[model samples]
Target: MSLADSPIRHPDTASRPLMTRRGWWLVGMNILIPGSAQVLAGDRRLGRFGLGATLVLWVVLVAAIVTWFAAPTVIYTIASNSVALWVVALGLVFYGVLWLVLTLDTLRLVRLVRTQPSARVPIAALTVLVLVVASGGAAYGAYLATTASGFLSSVFAAGPSEPPVDGRYNILLLGADTGPDREGTRPDSMTVASIDAETGQAVLIGLPRNLEDIHFPSDSPMAAAYPNGYGTEQGCLVDVCLLNSIYTEVEQVTPELYPDAAARNSTPGIEAMRDAASGVTGLTIQYFVLIDMQGFEALIDALGGVEITVEERLPIGGDENLQNVDGWVEAGTQRMNGYTALWYARSRYSATDYDRMQRQRVLQEAILRQFTPANVLTKFQAVAEAGAETVRTDIPQSMLGYFVDLAGKTRQLPIQSVELTPETGIEPAYPDWDAVHALIQDAIATATAEPTPAESAAG
Candidate 1:
């Protein structure tokens, strides 16, 4: 057969060459349909495969977009599942590499050098752009998914789902303090967030670090050691036991008490605190989120920093007395870095623990508000990495979908708090157990109950 009637396809034969417009159209087809260029003029086998993959991807994309608008929670549920995420990552990898190969083949068919020399540069540049966006973008996405999977695995344990109690999920939040200055890791900041299972309204119940004579659950391992409470008969100045010390005290004194905790990917110290928190609040703590206070600094830094109103001057670094202050975070509304924010939440120099606790709450609220979706999307990797290193929780990773949904709701509701301090008739040295339970219950009831006209108008 003559060249004009040749059965085999070749690159426009060197003699015929290609016009700039012809080459541009070929590249455009590949960019638009991924494999159309090949199917139209090149390899049908490879083109078919690429076309098939592209069709599936387009369908999935359209379905996902529709599902997001129709029922967003379903999307969230799927994204939270580790297995689903892995599948997504793998799919992106396979398709990304495949599309990249197809694009390069499309470029070869275009025969850039055969076109106007001027068009070759622009065409090559455009092809390079597509490769980066299609392949490089996919790689970045896979990295994020893998990062999330690792974070969930490291921070959240795999366990049976913990059901809420009394229409609420009481979560124990602890700021674990560990360093060379401290003997062992201590849950310095203890608060129980009692959340309405449906409404998502939350009531924060703060327990003072110095809370003494804290009674353990009747059946708790620590209960036998001190039947009356977790303290000595004589109290302070003798052999005193404070609430914050319970964690380290248990680990050091009775590490064997919770042997099963390790198997469940939990520590004895956390189990002990969960029991104590339950006993103290008279509410079952279904889950516990333990965050190392040191790592908390990094979390704040990841958000670029946080702004808090300081009504008083707070000392930075100091000793036992906190007298030799290295510097002071001057009074006024200020944006602080990790180190400064940490001190703002912990300064106990000339201030009482009550003041410090209040400051901690202030900082917590400020930081929590900073986690807007846009902000998180920008800084998620840093935040997730920091959390994996510093945060520990008993809540199963399987339940992440539910909790993530719950968190979205909670963010919309106003927060109420009850602090166990002198102002609330709670004495660190000797708190009235009956009164403490009553206050916590009342707080929860108020938080979950619908506000009346008069109560609503009080604003």
Candidate 2:
């Protein structure tokens, strides 16, 4: 027999099976189950490893969810820990690499099975597309987490402070205005947000900016400097003893008056204000968040502006001394941009600070209502950037996770407020501290109590 006719055969080609619909099935399975493709392709060892990784990933996700609900503080502590954040970031990167590798491996197996080039090309393209999308999503998620961690570190303090006292955390919220004309940042708006730790109910106690003779805690440095309370005796101008001026005063004299305060709080001015607020309200100030009024407009704009009801016309721009107005915000229910909202909260042309305070409260509530999860997801980067620029606080980063949870709860609850205005029988110049304390206590009690049937129905 002739040699060519006797044994014309290709052993490798004969043994390999032709690619069919099963090849596509394997690719789909690999995407869904991560390792089943390898198992069916006869690589049992690799398949087991891949499947194990998938199982571990699911386990971690479940554990995280359970911890979020069962022990949120733990999650917060971990998030605040730099080491933990780094580890998580690296883990995400590793997972992304693994996902890409598995995807490529699946495509390789599909190509290994003999198939028409046309069919193989489409399958490979689809596999690569899935890999790119999945890996990109993981990388993006990691980036966001890392960015948040850095932002938290920048804005929050290092160590955790004392927890809520008697089931409530009393935080001083200060709106600090820093301008070239002003000597330093002054807390133009001051409010104490007393929050219930368990239920997230909150009572905002608004202090008139012109509140005078504000006292400091007996043991506080401010108290040591001004034994007779922050008043005219301290060489404050006629209205310099006002609550709003405390921040500027303390900041200017911190080095000489309260050298030790700088060690505890990043902003000594806010610390002084906190002590003053605590002394007057008879409540412990656990933490203070100072919002830079310069960034106020940006933050409002980031939230797509806020809807507010203007009882009367509001001036857009003006100088207190000049009594000049640049523009006016028409009255009625209307949507306001950042500039209009800032003026709505700060304007004092024909309106008194008392009126501004009411407007400020309404604006604050409106911002809270508008900052829903949907809004945040839609404009996450903008909101994050604006928040980082606008907010400064002595609250520890480790405790932010707890506060995040609390804020979500707070958004669902009705906010109660008590204003120290003339109608409330509290004069800014000679406020009755005793009465003020009583009012705050009463508001907290009423707010923390379970809502009445009528109130619940209305809510």
Instruction: Find the candidate with the highest TM-score and give its number.
Output: 1
Which lDDT tens digits does candidate 2 get at residues 152-260? 6677788756778989999988888775576667788888999999878888888888888788788888787778867747466333567877777767655455566
- TM-score versus the correct structure, for each prediction: 0.90, 0.87
Global fold similarity of model 1 (TM-score): 0.90
Query: Which regions of candidate 2 deviate over 4 angstroms?
Result: 1-20, 68-81, 112-121, 237-239, 319-327, 332-337, 372-380, 452-459
- Model 1: lowest-lDDT 10 consecutive positions: 3-12
Model 1 agreement with the true structure over 1-459: per-residue lDDT tens digits: 553343224444453244466667778888899878777667889989889999999999999999977866677767766778788899989988987998899888777667877788998899989989989989988888888777777787878887888889998999888755886688778889898887677888888988888887888887877778877664422234788777876677777888888866778888888888988889988888888889988988887898888998877887667677899999999899888998898888778889888888777667666666558668879988787888888888777767766766677777888999999999878888999999998988887775533457896
Pairs that clash in candidate 2: none
lDDT score, candidate 1, position 229:
82
Top-lDDT structure, candidate number? 1
User: lDDT value for candidate 1?
Assistant: 0.80
